[model samples]
Target chain A: MGAEREPERGAERVVVGDKRKLRLATASLAGCFGCHMSLLDIDERLFELVERVDFDRSPLTDIKHCGACDIGLIEGGICNAENVHVLREFRSHCKVLIAVGACAVNGGLPAQRNHLDLGQCLQEIYLTAPDIVGGKIPNDPELPLPLDKVHPIHEIVRIDYFIPGCPPSGDAIWKFLTDLLDGRTPRLGHPLLHFD
Target chain B: MTQPSILLDGLPVPFVDGQTIMDAAMAADIFIPHLCHHPEFKPQGSCKLCTVKANGRYVSACTLPARDGMEVENNSPDLNDKRRTLLQMLFVEGNHFCPSCEKSGNCMLQALAYELEMLSPHFDQFYPNRAVDASHPEVLLDFNRCILCELCVRASRDVDRKSVFSLSGRGIDKHLIVNAESGRLADTDFSWADKAAHVCPVGVILKKRSGFAVPIGKRRYDVEPIGMQVERLAARSADEES
Candidate 1:
């Protein structure tokens, strides 16, 4: 099937056969690297992917700050002040932002702590545990202060699309990216759309 | 005279005197999505997933009786979007970790979410601090996954005559509880074979030692979506009656 064009979202659509490739960036915060690992599982297709898009800021490039990009893929939820800052910065730099995974979409497993009092949780782990000798809660100014509850990325910034899975499969990621590259609104069918 | 019928999204559905809109639609092989509804149990209109416009008024199909010549809107885009919102509400209300959940594929909540195309929870996560009750040797109760459907409560009380479960608390504090002073399943006379044991639509009630027995790809909703499964079941039942 021919790829369908999507409505523009603050960025120019990538034209196929154009020498200039689309700029793509990715970020992970308060999430396990499972989503990134799945992205790598795109394996051989990564060669084809690089041909269509130039990596701007990602672990693959080790570029800490995101530059102006066409697409930004965010993984994980907002659990700390730093995560909020990073997410906002990414939103400002990228034209289209996609929340990629259960964590970024709905605050995955780490959000299990949302009901517990953050102070009590820290105390229970650091001071009252069985193995404790002279334990105390760490008081470092450099530490990113934890938010009271975990929040999905959309709660912090506008999201153009959402890819919902624990860590969406390698094939799912490939399909989504290729759809964007081809100017189609990414639509994940039964096999691709999964939470687990 | 003639069989009583209702117009379901412009399609006619025949029904008997006492059948609800849900029953009529099911018998006609038209799927009206629902949760907290079982053919064997008394209809509880708590979930609101089966809401439909009955003659221009919204009502829960499971509880609203079908009337002859009544027009009902079942599969409209507006209704489906509302259902998606309800599903999203349920998702964020509980701490649902689908990746690690034992009931992932076979779970009705997950299956219905997929059926309705719910991409994200759409709301802030509550992440309630509920405990798991593993006291029963043959069963497990993960309070984090309960949608407060009360299916187990009805199954235990009406089918098994055991009254082994009940819901306690009000509003947001509402939750399922075992029928024992100790608040443990092992302290009660509950059995794995009880009807309530297997009635849970979510991961709240899980059978011990049987998790992952069926691989991920082989589970109930893996090959077919829940809508098709419901329709297929309806067709089979209609065939049996004929």
Candidate 2:
């Protein structure tokens, strides 16, 4: 509402003035870096995103562990305390919270480890996989956090949108951003978003 | 697609809604060359070979939504040139060793390439160093022959919701990555019963032991092509579901 006007042609986009530039932020928890990398998939179009929205605390651009903003894009699953705190803060601050990849949307890849007991998976990956880190973190704790089960972002807070994909394709990301910034509801595009 | 549509080289053709101009032309006995757009999978416009002139713009008939008064040209001289170039793009991009391929007799890509009379790939080979992960207890992978139409990715991710497969890398470096870590599908939770091994449009992904079970020159699809395979598969799917 900050002096943003109707788009010159479409119902959205400001024709003039400060353009009510939406304050935005993004973060990740415990999934593959693939989701964040998908943002880079935009190649050159990412410049348009920088111009349209203000990224206040993205892991890529910002140093602050957390911040208040309008749009919070959380990529990765919740398997630790840091994930919980960051997710809650984003939920409280952002006007719209988007679970921005498959892991965030429906407990993607990391959750694949759910098939076995947490202890067993830890022992298998560390003690069993070809190369063992062997208490690599030393005093540091392992994932699965013992007694608690891994959960998706929606389980912890209300999510306004879900952009699914192992990592969603760049075109899907572009469409969603265009739709949201333009105040139009977005439909999930490309069957990949629905894919694992 | 409501009326008997426009010319296919001056021949009158019929069309129906919820179908493409290619379908309409095919119904009127006109032939068009396309590699990736089997009537089975969702209309992937990746190949752009099935592209036809609709109201003077080059649009892929397989994926375009038809409208009234749309003038479609299926076999104009310019369109044939466009299609031949697109087919050549596919032909040169991958290792389509037709002499050694199993689906040679029934493959849509090979059949279309032959129909276009393409004798040699016009460009340099990509020669991607992809390892064949025949790791699935039931399925096989020959990464050399993959065209990345994403049919297997869709069938697994969308239909089965298994997400057992994915595409890694991008552009020229892009290739299929299955399961998770080992890149071995059997290491993940894929089962023999999953239909992903059945619907792959190319010979890249195959049903391992099931290969040649139907025998050469006698496979059910040898004479019928994919349109009928889809119809029969749909019926089989419904029967299995019930």
Best by TM-score: 1
Q: How well is candidate 1 docked (DockQ)?
A: 0.59
Off by over 4 Å in 2: A1-196, B1-18, B23-31, B212-242
- Model 2 TM-score, 2 decimals: 0.47
State the lDDT of candidate 2 residue by residue for A1-196, as single tens digits: 4345434334434443347678788888777778778887988998888878878888777757556677888898787787888889889888899887756755555554454577776667667778665543223555424324566777788888877655767777787888888889866532222222
lDDT of 1: 0.87
What local lDDT does model 2 show for residue A57?
A: 82
Residue pairs in collision within model 1: none
Runs in model 1 deviating more than 4 A are A1-20, A115-143, B231-242
lDDT of 1 by residue, B33-130 (tens): 88888777789999999999999999999999989999999999999999999999999888788988888877778888888888888787777778
Task: Report the C-alpha lDDT of model 1 over A2-63, residue by residue, as the tens digit.
Answer: 23334342124444444578999999998998999999999999999987899989999999
Q: Tell me the TM-score of model 1.
A: 0.88
Scored against the true structure, residue B68 in model 2 reaches a CA lDDT of 49
What is the per-candidate TM-score for chain B?
0.94, 0.79
| DockQ, each predicted model | 0.59, 0.01
